[model samples]
Target: MHSNVVGGSDRIGEIIEVRGADGTPPYRVRYPDGHESLMFPGPDCVIEQGSATAAAGRR
Candidate 1:
């Protein structure tokens, strides 16, 4: 997760399906084993995937 509130937080993940009314809702990400899990967001939440792990040093 990175900063989102102009000082808030932002996260990255492989999107599965965006569910909700305004398109802001929970997401599904694939695990290392190829299994997926739901990433539920709170009210007025948004998600974005950015730079690769290699570039972010997450690799």
Candidate 2:
């Protein structure tokens, strides 16, 4: 996700849980850092779904 702060790093993660439907906020994400957070994606954030091929590559 992109950050509103200048030079804030984007994060790549798996969506572990979704608190709402219909593209809602407060999503739980497990990041590559092995930490998780309940995120409310802001205007600067861009969420991308991981492809099956990409998931396989991680293993």
Candidate 3:
């Protein structure tokens, strides 16, 4: 996810839960650091599908 603050570090995570319907806010994501957060992504945030190779590497 993109940081709301200028020059802040951005993060990438796996979406573990969605609280509402499609295109809804307040998603639960588990980061690589093993931490999870409920987030409402802002304009700077983006979501991309993970590739098969990437997924395999995680396992």
> Between 1 and 2, whose TM-score is larger?
2
Model 3 segments beyond 4 Å from truth?
4-7, 51-59
TM-score of each: 0.40, 0.64, 0.67
Reference-based lDDT, residue 29, model 1: 65
lDDT of 2 by residue, 13-54 (tens): 787778988868789988888899998887767777889898
RMSD in angstroms, candidate 1?
7.8
Tell me the TM-score of model 1: 0.40
> Which residue pairs does candidate 3 place in steric collision?
1-11
TM-score of 3: 0.67
lDDT of 1 by residue, 1-59 (tens): 35447866455456556766676656666544567777776645545565666435634
Which ranking of candidates, highest lDDT first?
A: 3, 2, 1
The best candidate in terms of lDDT: 3
Ranking by TM-score: 3, 2, 1
**Whole-model Cα lDDT per candidate?**
0.59, 0.80, 0.83
The per-prediction CA RMSD against the true structure, in angstroms, equals: 7.8, 2.6, 2.5
